[model samples]
Target: MSVWAAVLALIIERVWGYPDRVYRILSHPVVWMGWVIGKGDETFNKPDETSFETGRLVGAVCLGAFLALVLVVTQPVARLFSALPGGWVFEAAVASSFLAQKSLGEAVARVAAALREGPIEAAREAVSHIVGRDTAGLDEAEISRAAIETLAENASDGVVAPLFYLVLFGLPGIAVYKAINTADSMIGHTSDRYRAFGWAAAKLDDVANFIPARLTALLIALAARWIPGAVPGGALRTARRDSIRHASPNAGWPEAALAGALGFGLGGPRAYKGEVLDLPAMGDGRRELDADDIDRALTLYRRLLDVLLGATVACAVVVWVV
Candidate 1:
Protein backbone atom coordinates (compact mmCIF):
# COMPACT_ATOMS: atom_id res chain seq x y z
CA MET A 1 0.00 0.00 0.00
CA SER A 2 2.76 2.44 0.88
CA VAL A 3 4.59 1.49 -2.31
CA TRP A 4 1.50 2.24 -4.36
CA ALA A 5 1.08 5.49 -2.45
CA ALA A 6 4.59 6.57 -3.45
CA VAL A 7 3.87 5.83 -7.09
CA LEU A 8 0.63 7.80 -7.04
CA ALA A 9 2.32 10.71 -5.32
CA LEU A 10 5.10 10.83 -7.88
CA ILE A 11 2.60 10.76 -10.72
CA ILE A 12 0.58 13.60 -9.22
CA GLU A 13 3.69 15.66 -8.61
CA ARG A 14 5.00 15.10 -12.12
CA VAL A 15 1.68 15.82 -13.81
CA TRP A 16 0.05 18.79 -12.05
CA GLY A 17 2.36 19.55 -9.14
CA TYR A 18 0.83 21.19 -6.08
CA PRO A 19 -1.48 23.84 -7.42
CA ASP A 20 -0.97 27.52 -6.59
CA ARG A 21 -4.58 27.85 -5.52
CA VAL A 22 -4.23 24.98 -3.08
CA TYR A 23 -0.99 26.50 -1.85
CA ARG A 24 -2.62 29.86 -1.37
CA ILE A 25 -5.27 28.23 0.77
CA LEU A 26 -3.10 25.74 2.67
CA SER A 27 0.38 27.15 2.33
CA HIS A 28 2.86 24.21 2.45
CA PRO A 29 3.92 21.63 4.96
CA VAL A 30 7.50 22.90 4.66
CA VAL A 31 6.37 26.48 5.25
CA TRP A 32 4.62 25.41 8.43
CA MET A 33 7.71 23.50 9.46
CA GLY A 34 9.82 26.60 8.79
CA TRP A 35 7.52 28.70 10.94
CA VAL A 36 7.91 26.24 13.80
CA ILE A 37 11.69 26.27 13.44
CA GLY A 38 11.75 30.05 13.21
CA LYS A 39 9.77 30.35 16.38
CA GLY A 40 11.99 27.83 18.11
CA ASP A 41 15.04 29.83 17.03
CA GLU A 42 13.53 33.07 18.30
CA THR A 43 12.74 31.44 21.60
CA PHE A 44 15.75 29.23 22.24
CA ASN A 45 18.75 30.37 20.18
CA LYS A 46 19.68 33.51 22.03
CA PRO A 47 23.41 34.01 21.85
CA ASP A 48 24.01 35.58 25.28
CA GLU A 49 21.42 33.50 27.11
CA THR A 50 22.36 29.97 26.14
CA SER A 51 25.63 28.04 26.23
CA PHE A 52 26.64 25.57 23.50
CA GLU A 53 25.45 22.54 25.43
CA THR A 54 22.23 24.34 26.31
CA GLY A 55 21.69 25.21 22.65
CA ARG A 56 22.27 21.64 21.62
CA LEU A 57 19.82 20.40 24.22
CA VAL A 58 17.22 22.91 23.08
CA GLY A 59 17.62 21.90 19.46
CA ALA A 60 17.21 18.24 20.35
CA VAL A 61 14.06 18.97 22.27
CA CYS A 62 12.73 21.04 19.41
CA LEU A 63 13.42 18.26 16.95
CA GLY A 64 11.74 15.73 19.15
CA ALA A 65 8.72 17.94 19.70
CA PHE A 66 8.28 18.56 15.98
CA LEU A 67 8.59 14.90 15.15
CA ALA A 68 6.00 14.01 17.75
CA LEU A 69 3.64 16.65 16.47
CA VAL A 70 3.87 15.36 12.89
CA LEU A 71 3.40 11.75 13.89
CA VAL A 72 0.45 12.59 16.09
CA VAL A 73 -1.35 14.45 13.31
CA THR A 74 -0.45 12.33 10.32
CA GLN A 75 -0.84 8.86 11.79
CA PRO A 76 -4.47 9.42 12.63
CA VAL A 77 -5.03 10.91 9.21
CA ALA A 78 -3.39 7.94 7.56
CA ARG A 79 -5.59 5.61 9.60
CA LEU A 80 -8.65 7.57 8.57
CA PHE A 81 -7.72 7.34 4.90
CA SER A 82 -7.00 3.63 5.12
CA ALA A 83 -10.54 2.99 6.41
CA LEU A 84 -12.16 4.63 3.34
CA PRO A 85 -12.54 3.41 -0.23
CA GLY A 86 -9.56 4.24 -2.48
CA GLY A 87 -8.29 6.37 0.39
CA TRP A 88 -4.68 5.92 -0.64
CA VAL A 89 -5.37 8.37 -3.41
CA PHE A 90 -5.97 11.16 -0.91
CA GLU A 91 -3.02 10.04 1.14
CA ALA A 92 -0.90 9.98 -2.01
CA ALA A 93 -1.97 13.48 -2.96
CA VAL A 94 -0.97 14.65 0.48
CA ALA A 95 2.33 12.85 0.06
CA SER A 96 2.85 14.49 -3.32
CA SER A 97 2.70 17.89 -1.63
CA PHE A 98 5.92 17.03 0.17
CA LEU A 99 7.79 16.03 -2.98
CA ALA A 100 9.14 18.84 -5.21
CA GLN A 101 9.94 17.13 -8.51
CA LYS A 102 8.05 19.45 -10.86
CA SER A 103 8.67 22.57 -8.80
CA LEU A 104 12.41 21.94 -8.62
CA GLY A 105 12.64 21.43 -12.34
CA GLU A 106 10.57 24.53 -13.07
CA ALA A 107 12.61 26.66 -10.67
CA VAL A 108 15.89 25.52 -12.24
CA ALA A 109 14.44 26.02 -15.73
CA ARG A 110 13.59 29.62 -14.83
CA VAL A 111 17.24 30.24 -13.97
CA ALA A 112 18.26 28.84 -17.33
CA ALA A 113 15.67 30.98 -19.07
CA ALA A 114 16.80 34.09 -17.23
CA LEU A 115 20.40 33.42 -18.19
CA ARG A 116 19.49 32.92 -21.82
CA GLU A 117 17.33 36.03 -22.24
CA GLY A 118 18.11 38.49 -19.48
CA PRO A 119 21.00 40.47 -18.03
CA ILE A 120 23.61 38.87 -15.77
CA GLU A 121 21.98 40.56 -12.77
CA ALA A 122 18.65 39.01 -13.63
CA ALA A 123 20.24 35.61 -13.88
CA ARG A 124 21.97 36.15 -10.55
CA GLU A 125 18.67 37.12 -8.94
CA ALA A 126 16.99 34.01 -10.30
CA VAL A 127 19.68 31.63 -9.11
CA SER A 128 19.89 33.28 -5.68
CA HIS A 129 16.43 32.00 -4.77
CA ILE A 130 17.65 28.39 -4.90
CA VAL A 131 21.23 28.67 -3.63
CA GLY A 132 22.78 29.96 -0.41
CA ARG A 133 25.94 31.35 -2.00
CA ASP A 134 26.63 35.02 -2.71
CA THR A 135 25.61 35.72 -6.29
CA ALA A 136 26.27 39.46 -6.54
CA GLY A 137 29.80 39.23 -7.93
CA LEU A 138 29.38 36.11 -10.09
CA ASP A 139 30.15 36.11 -13.82
CA GLU A 140 28.07 34.23 -16.37
CA ALA A 141 30.04 31.00 -15.96
CA GLU A 142 29.90 31.20 -12.20
CA ILE A 143 26.18 31.89 -12.26
CA SER A 144 25.57 28.92 -14.50
CA ARG A 145 27.73 26.75 -12.29
CA ALA A 146 25.76 27.76 -9.21
CA ALA A 147 22.43 26.99 -10.87
CA ILE A 148 23.53 23.59 -12.23
CA GLU A 149 25.13 22.63 -8.93
CA THR A 150 21.89 23.41 -7.13
CA LEU A 151 19.91 21.35 -9.62
CA ALA A 152 22.10 18.34 -8.97
CA GLU A 153 22.21 18.66 -5.20
CA ASN A 154 18.50 19.31 -4.81
CA ALA A 155 17.71 16.28 -6.96
CA SER A 156 18.61 14.47 -3.77
CA ASP A 157 17.13 16.80 -1.18
CA GLY A 158 13.89 17.88 -2.82
CA VAL A 159 13.00 14.61 -4.53
CA VAL A 160 15.00 11.44 -3.88
CA ALA A 161 15.51 11.76 -0.13
CA PRO A 162 11.80 12.15 0.59
CA LEU A 163 10.92 9.27 -1.71
CA PHE A 164 13.57 7.12 -0.09
CA TYR A 165 12.09 7.65 3.36
CA LEU A 166 8.57 7.20 2.04
CA VAL A 167 9.39 3.73 0.83
CA LEU A 168 10.90 2.76 4.19
CA PHE A 169 8.38 4.15 6.67
CA GLY A 170 5.53 5.65 4.68
CA LEU A 171 4.21 9.23 5.13
CA PRO A 172 5.62 9.66 8.63
CA GLY A 173 9.07 8.87 7.31
CA ILE A 174 8.97 11.59 4.68
CA ALA A 175 7.40 14.09 7.07
CA VAL A 176 10.18 13.72 9.60
CA TYR A 177 12.78 14.06 6.86
CA LYS A 178 11.24 17.33 5.66
CA ALA A 179 11.10 18.71 9.18
CA ILE A 180 14.75 17.94 9.74
CA ASN A 181 15.67 19.41 6.36
CA THR A 182 13.72 22.58 7.14
CA ALA A 183 15.43 23.01 10.49
CA ASP A 184 18.81 22.47 8.90
CA SER A 185 18.10 25.08 6.26
CA MET A 186 16.93 27.52 8.91
CA ILE A 187 19.68 27.06 11.49
CA GLY A 188 22.41 24.78 10.16
CA HIS A 189 25.30 27.12 9.50
CA THR A 190 28.77 27.90 10.82
CA SER A 191 27.97 31.49 11.61
CA ASP A 192 28.44 32.63 15.21
CA ARG A 193 24.73 32.59 16.03
CA TYR A 194 24.13 29.12 14.57
CA ARG A 195 27.39 27.22 15.15
CA ALA A 196 26.31 25.71 18.46
CA PHE A 197 22.56 25.68 18.12
CA GLY A 198 22.41 24.27 14.59
CA TRP A 199 24.76 21.36 15.26
CA ALA A 200 22.05 18.82 16.00
CA ALA A 201 19.91 19.87 13.04
CA ALA A 202 22.90 19.79 10.71
CA LYS A 203 24.17 16.43 11.92
CA LEU A 204 20.73 14.87 11.93
CA ASP A 205 20.04 16.07 8.42
CA ASP A 206 23.37 14.64 7.27
CA VAL A 207 22.50 11.27 8.70
CA ALA A 208 19.07 11.34 7.12
CA ASN A 209 20.55 12.28 3.76
CA PHE A 210 23.46 9.82 3.74
CA ILE A 211 21.89 6.88 1.89
CA PRO A 212 19.55 8.87 -0.35
CA ALA A 213 22.33 11.13 -1.60
CA ARG A 214 24.40 8.19 -2.80
CA LEU A 215 21.29 6.64 -4.33
CA THR A 216 20.67 9.89 -6.20
CA ALA A 217 24.20 9.78 -7.58
CA LEU A 218 23.70 6.18 -8.66
CA LEU A 219 20.47 7.10 -10.41
CA ILE A 220 22.21 9.94 -12.18
CA ALA A 221 24.94 7.58 -13.35
CA LEU A 222 22.29 5.18 -14.62
CA ALA A 223 20.48 7.98 -16.40
CA ALA A 224 23.72 9.03 -18.03
CA ARG A 225 24.18 5.54 -19.45
CA TRP A 226 20.75 5.50 -21.11
CA ILE A 227 20.03 9.17 -21.79
CA PRO A 228 22.04 10.54 -24.72
CA GLY A 229 24.08 13.68 -24.03
CA ALA A 230 23.43 13.25 -20.29
CA VAL A 231 26.93 12.32 -19.18
CA PRO A 232 29.53 12.93 -21.84
CA GLY A 233 32.17 13.48 -19.15
CA GLY A 234 32.26 10.01 -17.48
CA ALA A 235 30.05 10.35 -14.38
CA LEU A 236 30.98 7.16 -12.54
CA ARG A 237 34.75 7.60 -12.56
CA THR A 238 34.64 11.33 -11.81
CA ALA A 239 32.18 10.80 -8.97
CA ARG A 240 34.32 8.09 -7.40
CA ARG A 241 37.44 10.27 -7.55
CA ASP A 242 36.15 13.77 -6.61
CA SER A 243 32.93 13.30 -4.65
CA ILE A 244 34.77 13.10 -1.35
CA ARG A 245 36.51 16.39 -2.01
CA HIS A 246 33.36 18.48 -1.51
CA ALA A 247 32.70 20.45 1.70
CA SER A 248 29.55 18.40 2.27
CA PRO A 249 29.57 14.64 2.59
CA ASN A 250 26.31 14.06 0.67
CA ALA A 251 25.98 17.09 -1.62
CA GLY A 252 29.23 16.15 -3.31
CA TRP A 253 27.84 12.87 -4.61
CA PRO A 254 25.20 14.28 -6.94
CA GLU A 255 27.28 17.33 -7.77
CA ALA A 256 30.22 15.15 -8.82
CA ALA A 257 27.95 12.89 -10.83
CA LEU A 258 26.43 15.90 -12.56
CA ALA A 259 29.78 17.55 -13.25
CA GLY A 260 31.01 14.29 -14.75
CA ALA A 261 27.80 13.86 -16.73
CA LEU A 262 27.95 17.37 -18.16
CA GLY A 263 31.63 17.20 -19.06
CA PHE A 264 32.45 20.09 -16.73
CA GLY A 265 34.15 20.98 -13.47
CA LEU A 266 32.01 22.38 -10.66
CA GLY A 267 32.68 23.54 -7.08
CA GLY A 268 36.01 25.12 -6.05
CA PRO A 269 36.15 28.47 -4.20
CA ARG A 270 32.57 29.72 -3.99
CA ALA A 271 31.49 32.59 -1.73
CA TYR A 272 28.96 32.21 1.08
CA LYS A 273 27.68 35.49 2.39
CA GLY A 274 30.86 37.51 1.84
CA GLU A 275 33.39 34.83 2.75
CA VAL A 276 35.10 32.93 -0.06
CA LEU A 277 35.89 29.33 0.84
CA ASP A 278 38.60 27.50 -1.09
CA LEU A 279 36.86 24.27 -2.00
CA PRO A 280 38.06 21.52 -4.36
CA ALA A 281 36.55 21.16 -7.80
CA MET A 282 34.57 18.05 -8.69
CA GLY A 283 35.18 17.18 -12.39
CA ASP A 284 38.21 17.67 -14.65
CA GLY A 285 36.21 18.76 -17.68
CA ARG A 286 35.13 22.26 -18.71
CA ARG A 287 35.14 25.10 -16.20
CA GLU A 288 33.43 27.53 -18.50
CA LEU A 289 29.75 26.85 -17.67
CA ASP A 290 26.94 28.51 -19.59
CA ALA A 291 23.12 28.64 -19.92
CA ASP A 292 23.30 25.63 -22.17
CA ASP A 293 24.83 23.69 -19.31
CA ILE A 294 21.85 24.53 -17.14
CA ASP A 295 19.55 23.23 -19.85
CA ARG A 296 21.54 20.05 -20.07
CA ALA A 297 21.37 19.58 -16.31
CA LEU A 298 17.59 19.97 -16.44
CA THR A 299 17.42 17.39 -19.18
CA LEU A 300 19.37 14.95 -17.06
CA TYR A 301 17.23 15.73 -14.02
CA ARG A 302 14.07 14.98 -16.01
CA ARG A 303 15.51 11.69 -17.14
CA LEU A 304 16.44 10.84 -13.58
CA LEU A 305 12.85 11.48 -12.53
CA ASP A 306 11.69 9.00 -15.15
CA VAL A 307 14.13 6.49 -13.73
CA LEU A 308 12.73 7.06 -10.25
CA LEU A 309 9.18 6.62 -11.51
CA GLY A 310 10.11 3.34 -13.16
CA ALA A 311 11.78 2.12 -9.98
CA THR A 312 8.74 3.10 -7.93
CA VAL A 313 6.40 1.22 -10.24
CA ALA A 314 8.51 -1.92 -10.18
CA CYS A 315 8.82 -1.82 -6.40
CA ALA A 316 5.10 -1.23 -5.97
CA VAL A 317 4.30 -4.18 -8.17
CA VAL A 318 6.60 -6.44 -6.19
CA VAL A 319 5.15 -5.33 -2.88
CA TRP A 320 1.57 -5.85 -4.06
CA VAL A 321 2.31 -9.31 -5.39
CA VAL A 322 4.36 -10.42 -2.44
Candidate 2:
Protein backbone atom coordinates (compact mmCIF):
# COMPACT_ATOMS: atom_id res chain seq x y z
CA MET A 1 0.00 0.00 0.00
CA SER A 2 2.76 2.41 0.92
CA VAL A 3 4.76 1.67 -2.20
CA TRP A 4 1.75 2.09 -4.48
CA ALA A 5 0.89 5.37 -2.80
CA ALA A 6 4.40 6.65 -3.39
CA VAL A 7 4.29 5.65 -7.05
CA LEU A 8 0.94 7.28 -7.59
CA ALA A 9 2.03 10.48 -5.87
CA LEU A 10 5.23 10.69 -7.89
CA ILE A 11 3.39 10.03 -11.13
CA ILE A 12 0.87 12.76 -10.41
CA GLU A 13 3.63 15.21 -9.51
CA ARG A 14 5.62 14.51 -12.64
CA VAL A 15 2.74 14.49 -15.13
CA TRP A 16 0.34 17.16 -13.94
CA GLY A 17 2.53 19.00 -11.42
CA TYR A 18 0.43 21.40 -9.35
CA PRO A 19 -1.68 23.69 -11.45
CA ASP A 20 -2.97 26.75 -9.60
CA ARG A 21 -6.52 26.24 -10.77
CA VAL A 22 -6.43 22.60 -9.65
CA TYR A 23 -5.17 23.58 -6.22
CA ARG A 24 -7.74 26.35 -5.96
CA ILE A 25 -10.55 23.90 -6.69
CA LEU A 26 -9.32 21.03 -4.49
CA SER A 27 -8.25 23.20 -1.52
CA HIS A 28 -11.67 24.83 -1.38
CA PRO A 29 -13.30 21.68 0.00
CA VAL A 30 -10.54 21.02 2.55
CA VAL A 31 -10.49 24.63 3.69
CA TRP A 32 -14.25 24.79 4.03
CA MET A 33 -14.32 21.47 5.89
CA GLY A 34 -11.56 22.74 8.14
CA TRP A 35 -13.46 25.95 8.81
CA VAL A 36 -16.61 24.07 9.77
CA ILE A 37 -14.71 21.71 12.05
CA GLY A 38 -12.84 24.64 13.54
CA LYS A 39 -16.09 26.45 14.34
CA GLY A 40 -17.53 23.35 16.04
CA ASP A 41 -14.40 22.84 18.10
CA GLU A 42 -14.48 26.47 19.16
CA THR A 43 -18.10 26.18 20.24
CA PHE A 44 -17.36 23.13 22.39
CA ASN A 45 -14.04 24.49 23.62
CA LYS A 46 -15.29 25.66 26.99
CA PRO A 47 -12.90 25.65 29.91
CA ASP A 48 -13.77 22.70 32.12
CA GLU A 49 -12.08 20.64 34.77
CA THR A 50 -11.19 17.88 32.37
CA SER A 51 -8.58 15.35 33.44
CA PHE A 52 -5.51 14.76 31.29
CA GLU A 53 -6.64 11.20 30.77
CA THR A 54 -10.06 12.43 29.65
CA GLY A 55 -8.49 14.84 27.22
CA ARG A 56 -6.37 12.05 25.82
CA LEU A 57 -9.45 9.87 25.53
CA VAL A 58 -11.38 12.59 23.76
CA GLY A 59 -8.49 13.13 21.38
CA ALA A 60 -8.27 9.44 20.68
CA VAL A 61 -11.98 9.27 19.95
CA CYS A 62 -11.77 12.28 17.67
CA LEU A 63 -8.84 10.78 15.82
CA GLY A 64 -10.64 7.47 15.48
CA ALA A 65 -13.72 9.15 14.07
CA PHE A 66 -11.59 10.99 11.54
CA LEU A 67 -9.93 7.78 10.41
CA ALA A 68 -13.27 6.03 10.05
CA LEU A 69 -14.67 8.88 8.00
CA VAL A 70 -11.70 8.96 5.68
CA LEU A 71 -11.45 5.22 5.22
CA VAL A 72 -15.12 4.32 5.15
CA VAL A 73 -16.65 7.49 3.74
CA THR A 74 -14.08 9.47 1.77
CA GLN A 75 -12.43 6.50 0.08
CA PRO A 76 -15.79 5.25 -1.13
CA VAL A 77 -16.58 8.67 -2.46
CA ALA A 78 -13.26 8.76 -4.28
CA ARG A 79 -13.96 5.34 -5.77
CA LEU A 80 -17.39 6.46 -6.88
CA PHE A 81 -15.79 9.36 -8.68
CA SER A 82 -13.19 6.99 -10.08
CA ALA A 83 -15.97 4.88 -11.59
CA LEU A 84 -16.72 7.69 -14.00
CA PRO A 85 -15.41 7.68 -17.57
CA GLY A 86 -12.35 9.61 -16.51
CA GLY A 87 -12.32 8.28 -12.94
CA TRP A 88 -8.57 7.97 -12.78
CA VAL A 89 -8.29 11.68 -13.49
CA PHE A 90 -10.41 12.43 -10.46
CA GLU A 91 -8.24 10.16 -8.32
CA ALA A 92 -5.10 11.90 -9.52
CA ALA A 93 -6.65 15.24 -8.76
CA VAL A 94 -7.46 14.11 -5.26
CA ALA A 95 -3.92 12.87 -4.70
CA SER A 96 -2.31 16.01 -6.08
CA SER A 97 -4.52 18.22 -3.98
CA PHE A 98 -3.14 16.72 -0.76
CA LEU A 99 0.46 17.30 -1.82
CA ALA A 100 1.99 20.75 -1.21
CA GLN A 101 5.23 20.85 -3.23
CA LYS A 102 4.20 23.73 -5.48
CA SER A 103 2.00 25.55 -3.00
CA LEU A 104 4.81 25.81 -0.46
CA GLY A 105 7.27 27.26 -2.94
CA GLU A 106 4.73 29.72 -4.32
CA ALA A 107 3.72 30.90 -0.84
CA VAL A 108 7.33 31.50 0.20
CA ALA A 109 8.19 33.13 -3.11
CA ARG A 110 5.34 35.60 -2.75
CA VAL A 111 6.78 36.73 0.56
CA ALA A 112 10.23 37.11 -0.93
CA ALA A 113 8.88 39.12 -3.84
CA ALA A 114 6.83 41.31 -1.54
CA LEU A 115 9.88 42.06 0.57
CA ARG A 116 11.95 42.87 -2.47
CA GLU A 117 9.43 45.35 -3.82
CA GLY A 118 8.31 47.34 -0.76
CA PRO A 119 10.76 46.55 2.05
CA ILE A 120 9.13 46.91 5.48
CA GLU A 121 5.51 47.21 4.34
CA ALA A 122 5.94 44.33 1.93
CA ALA A 123 7.57 42.31 4.67
CA ARG A 124 4.78 43.14 7.09
CA GLU A 125 2.22 41.73 4.71
CA ALA A 126 4.29 38.65 3.92
CA VAL A 127 4.93 37.98 7.59
CA SER A 128 1.19 37.60 8.19
CA HIS A 129 1.07 34.65 5.79
CA ILE A 130 4.06 32.90 7.34
CA VAL A 131 4.45 33.82 11.03
CA GLY A 132 2.34 34.46 14.12
CA ARG A 133 4.16 37.70 14.89
CA ASP A 134 3.13 41.31 15.22
CA THR A 135 4.31 42.59 11.86
CA ALA A 136 3.08 46.13 12.21
CA GLY A 137 6.23 47.44 13.90
CA LEU A 138 8.78 44.97 12.61
CA ASP A 139 11.72 46.40 10.68
CA GLU A 140 13.02 45.02 7.39
CA ALA A 141 15.43 42.66 9.08
CA GLU A 142 12.81 41.25 11.43
CA ILE A 143 10.32 40.68 8.63
CA SER A 144 12.88 38.85 6.52
CA ARG A 145 13.90 36.76 9.50
CA ALA A 146 10.30 35.80 10.17
CA ALA A 147 9.72 34.85 6.54
CA ILE A 148 12.79 32.61 6.49
CA GLU A 149 11.70 30.91 9.67
CA THR A 150 8.26 30.25 8.25
CA LEU A 151 9.74 28.85 5.05
CA ALA A 152 11.73 26.29 6.99
CA GLU A 153 8.94 25.27 9.36
CA ASN A 154 6.34 24.95 6.66
CA ALA A 155 8.72 22.88 4.55
CA SER A 156 8.20 20.16 7.12
CA ASP A 157 4.59 20.80 8.11
CA GLY A 158 3.12 21.69 4.76
CA VAL A 159 5.20 19.45 2.49
CA VAL A 160 7.20 16.59 3.94
CA ALA A 161 4.88 15.58 6.80
CA PRO A 162 1.81 15.11 4.63
CA LEU A 163 3.81 13.21 2.02
CA PHE A 164 5.30 11.00 4.68
CA TYR A 165 1.89 9.90 5.95
CA LEU A 166 0.49 9.52 2.45
CA VAL A 167 3.34 7.15 1.61
CA LEU A 168 2.72 5.20 4.78
CA PHE A 169 -1.06 4.88 4.69
CA GLY A 170 -2.50 6.45 1.54
CA LEU A 171 -5.16 9.16 1.26
CA PRO A 172 -6.80 8.11 4.50
CA GLY A 173 -3.65 8.70 6.44
CA ILE A 174 -3.07 12.07 4.82
CA ALA A 175 -6.62 13.13 5.56
CA VAL A 176 -6.39 12.11 9.19
CA TYR A 177 -3.06 13.84 9.61
CA LYS A 178 -4.40 17.04 8.10
CA ALA A 179 -7.44 16.93 10.32
CA ILE A 180 -5.28 16.48 13.42
CA ASN A 181 -2.94 19.22 12.28
CA THR A 182 -5.84 21.57 11.71
CA ALA A 183 -7.18 20.77 15.15
CA ASP A 184 -3.82 21.52 16.71
CA SER A 185 -3.45 24.79 14.84
CA MET A 186 -6.89 25.89 15.94
CA ILE A 187 -6.86 24.82 19.60
CA GLY A 188 -3.55 23.26 20.51
CA HIS A 189 -1.80 25.70 22.81
CA THR A 190 -0.69 26.25 26.38
CA SER A 191 -3.18 29.03 27.02
CA ASP A 192 -5.82 28.72 29.71
CA ARG A 193 -8.53 27.71 27.25
CA TYR A 194 -6.63 24.90 25.54
CA ARG A 195 -3.79 23.96 27.87
CA ALA A 196 -5.45 20.76 29.01
CA PHE A 197 -7.76 19.60 26.22
CA GLY A 198 -5.46 20.58 23.43
CA TRP A 199 -2.59 18.57 24.87
CA ALA A 200 -3.39 15.44 22.86
CA ALA A 201 -3.63 17.25 19.56
CA ALA A 202 -0.36 19.10 20.19
CA LYS A 203 1.49 16.03 21.36
CA LEU A 204 0.19 13.80 18.56
CA ASP A 205 1.19 16.37 15.96
CA ASP A 206 4.64 16.53 17.56
CA VAL A 207 4.98 12.76 17.36
CA ALA A 208 3.77 12.58 13.76
CA ASN A 209 6.17 15.32 12.66
CA PHE A 210 9.21 14.16 14.62
CA ILE A 211 11.01 12.19 11.91
CA PRO A 212 9.74 14.19 8.94
CA ALA A 213 11.03 17.48 10.38
CA ARG A 214 14.51 16.10 10.90
CA LEU A 215 14.51 14.61 7.41
CA THR A 216 13.46 17.98 6.00
CA ALA A 217 16.40 19.64 7.74
CA LEU A 218 18.85 17.13 6.29
CA LEU A 219 17.42 17.62 2.81
CA ILE A 220 17.65 21.39 3.22
CA ALA A 221 21.27 21.11 4.28
CA LEU A 222 22.06 18.98 1.24
CA ALA A 223 20.28 21.54 -0.92
CA ALA A 224 22.39 24.30 0.61
CA ARG A 225 25.53 22.56 -0.55
CA TRP A 226 24.14 22.37 -4.07
CA ILE A 227 23.11 26.01 -4.28
CA PRO A 228 25.71 28.52 -5.50
CA GLY A 229 26.37 30.60 -2.39
CA ALA A 230 25.00 28.51 0.49
CA VAL A 231 27.29 27.31 3.30
CA PRO A 232 26.38 23.62 3.63
CA GLY A 233 29.14 22.68 6.10
CA GLY A 234 28.19 25.18 8.78
CA ALA A 235 24.50 24.70 8.06
CA LEU A 236 24.71 20.97 8.82
CA ARG A 237 26.38 21.52 12.20
CA THR A 238 24.04 24.34 13.21
CA ALA A 239 20.94 22.32 12.27
CA ARG A 240 21.95 19.40 14.53
CA ARG A 241 22.86 21.57 17.54
CA ASP A 242 20.17 24.27 17.39
CA SER A 243 17.20 22.12 16.28
CA ILE A 244 16.28 21.32 19.87
CA ARG A 245 16.71 24.91 21.09
CA HIS A 246 13.50 26.39 19.71
CA ALA A 247 10.37 25.93 21.80
CA SER A 248 9.19 23.29 19.35
CA PRO A 249 11.29 20.12 19.40
CA ASN A 250 10.62 19.68 15.66
CA ALA A 251 10.53 23.17 14.08
CA GLY A 252 13.99 24.18 15.24
CA TRP A 253 15.91 21.78 13.00
CA PRO A 254 14.83 23.15 9.64
CA GLU A 255 14.85 26.78 10.80
CA ALA A 256 18.32 26.42 12.24
CA ALA A 257 19.60 24.80 9.04
CA LEU A 258 18.07 27.54 6.92
CA ALA A 259 19.48 30.23 9.19
CA GLY A 260 22.98 28.77 9.11
CA ALA A 261 22.87 28.18 5.36
CA LEU A 262 22.00 31.81 4.78
CA GLY A 263 24.40 33.14 7.42
CA PHE A 264 21.66 34.67 9.60
CA GLY A 265 19.89 33.88 12.87
CA LEU A 266 16.22 33.20 13.56
CA GLY A 267 13.67 32.24 16.30
CA GLY A 268 14.35 34.78 19.02
CA PRO A 269 11.80 37.14 20.65
CA ARG A 270 8.45 37.06 18.92
CA ALA A 271 5.25 38.95 19.71
CA TYR A 272 1.97 37.06 19.71
CA LYS A 273 -1.07 39.31 19.45
CA GLY A 274 0.33 42.12 21.63
CA GLU A 275 2.37 40.12 24.14
CA VAL A 276 6.10 39.67 23.64
CA LEU A 277 7.71 36.32 24.41
CA ASP A 278 11.42 35.75 24.54
CA LEU A 279 12.32 32.70 22.43
CA PRO A 280 15.66 30.98 21.97
CA ALA A 281 17.57 31.75 18.78
CA MET A 282 18.25 29.00 16.24
CA GLY A 283 21.65 29.77 14.68
CA ASP A 284 24.93 30.36 16.48
CA GLY A 285 25.92 33.69 14.94
CA ARG A 286 23.71 36.71 14.33
CA ARG A 287 23.98 38.44 10.99
CA GLU A 288 21.89 41.20 9.50
CA LEU A 289 19.00 39.70 7.50
CA ASP A 290 17.48 41.42 4.51
CA ALA A 291 15.58 40.82 1.28
CA ASP A 292 18.67 39.22 -0.23
CA ASP A 293 18.67 36.63 2.52
CA ILE A 294 15.06 35.86 1.74
CA ASP A 295 16.02 35.28 -1.87
CA ARG A 296 18.76 32.89 -0.83
CA ALA A 297 16.28 31.06 1.34
CA LEU A 298 13.94 30.73 -1.64
CA THR A 299 16.78 29.34 -3.68
CA LEU A 300 17.35 26.73 -1.04
CA TYR A 301 13.61 26.04 -0.94
CA ARG A 302 13.53 25.36 -4.68
CA ARG A 303 16.48 23.02 -4.34
CA LEU A 304 14.74 21.17 -1.54
CA LEU A 305 11.78 20.67 -3.85
CA ASP A 306 14.08 19.10 -6.39
CA VAL A 307 15.58 16.84 -3.77
CA LEU A 308 12.15 15.68 -2.62
CA LEU A 309 10.98 15.04 -6.16
CA GLY A 310 14.10 13.02 -6.88
CA ALA A 311 13.62 11.01 -3.71
CA THR A 312 10.05 10.25 -4.63
CA VAL A 313 11.16 9.00 -8.02
CA ALA A 314 13.81 6.82 -6.46
CA CYS A 315 11.31 5.37 -4.03
CA ALA A 316 8.88 4.69 -6.82
CA VAL A 317 11.50 2.88 -8.87
CA VAL A 318 12.49 0.72 -5.94
CA VAL A 319 8.87 -0.14 -5.26
CA TRP A 320 8.17 -0.95 -8.92
CA VAL A 321 11.19 -3.22 -9.32
CA VAL A 322 10.73 -5.01 -6.04
- By lDDT, who's the top model here? 1
Q: List the residue pairs that clash in candidate 2.
A: none
Q: Rate the local accuracy (lDDT) of all candidates.
A: 0.88, 0.74
148 Cα displacement, candidate 2 (Å): 0.5
Which lDDT tens digits does candidate 1 get at residues 96-124?
98899999999888888998898888999
Q: How does each model score on TM-score?
A: 0.97, 0.87
Candidate 1 regions exceeding 4 Å error are 230-233
For model 1, where is the 10-residue window of minimal lDDT?
225-234
Error of 2 at 221 (Å): 1.6
TM-score of 2: 0.87
The numbered model that scores best in TM-score is: 1
